[model samples]
Target: MARRERTRHLIELGGLVQKAGLVELADDDRATLYGAMLDCAARVQADDAGTVLALWKRRGKRAFDAEETAEEEQR
Candidate 1:
């Protein structure tokens, strides 16, 4: 059960990557996608990581909220 849950979690993360257009932007190249993700990780490891992470968190929340609003309007 735990393994299944972990699989689902990873799949959802992959879905976010696809949703963000990285898959298409990278021409479906796994290496490019992984490299981009590693770049993001490196940025978050910087001295001002907290500020960078907060900005990203806010942007993600706004995107999620916007998506939800659009879906609700469609319904």
Candidate 2:
């Protein structure tokens, strides 16, 4: 990916974390955040993966839709 695109992708992912309150849950502990991500990865790799993915997809779309709505309201 282009550098700018990659940077934007990373920023968006960080925003998702902030939207989900993960940053506050981590309490500035990088290790805790990393560990939580590893655990999520393991869950995604395990059985019933669709369940995890579907839930995440719903949540992510909800966040994106909310942002879009907020922007439209601002306009």
Candidate 3:
């Protein structure tokens, strides 16, 4: 990916962590945060992933779209 795209990807992933309440759950511990993400990755690979992922994706998209709309309206 290009540098700009990579940066945006990282920012979005960070937002997901924040949105999931992981920041507080990890309590500023890098290892804890990483381990939690790893666990999540593993869980996503399990059965029922499709249904779970669809719901998550829908929520994330709605949140991102709402933020964009709010920002545009503010301008």
Kindly give the number of clashing pairs for every candidate: 0, 0, 0
> With candidate 2 superimposed using the best TM-score fit, by how many Å does residue 48's alpha carbon deviate from the native?
2.0
Question: What order do candidates take by TM-score, descending?
Answer: 1, 2, 3
Clashing pairs in 3: none
Off by over 4 Å in 2: 63-75
Least lDDT summed over 10 consecutive residues: which range in candidate 2?
A: 14-23
Candidate 1, residue 26: the lDDT equals 100
lDDT of 2 by residue, 8-59 (tens): 9999988777878888999968899889999999989985999989999998
Model 2, position 20, has a per-residue lDDT of 80
| lDDT score, candidate 3, position 3 | 95
Task: Flag the better candidate by lDDT, 2 or 3.
Answer: 2
1 versus 2: better lDDT goes to: 1
If both were scored by TM-score, which would come out higher, candidate 1 or candidate 2? Answer: 1
Per-residue accuracy of model 1 over 1-75 as CA lDDT, tens digit each: 999999999999999999888999999999999999999999889749989999989999999999999999999
Alpha-carbon RMSD of each model: 0.8, 2.2, 3.1
Model 2 vs. true fold: TM: 0.75
Q: lDDT at 64 for candidate 1?
A: 94
Query: lDDT by residue for model 3 over 1-75, one digit each (tens)?
Result: 599999999999898888778898889788999997788788888858998799878997998899899999999
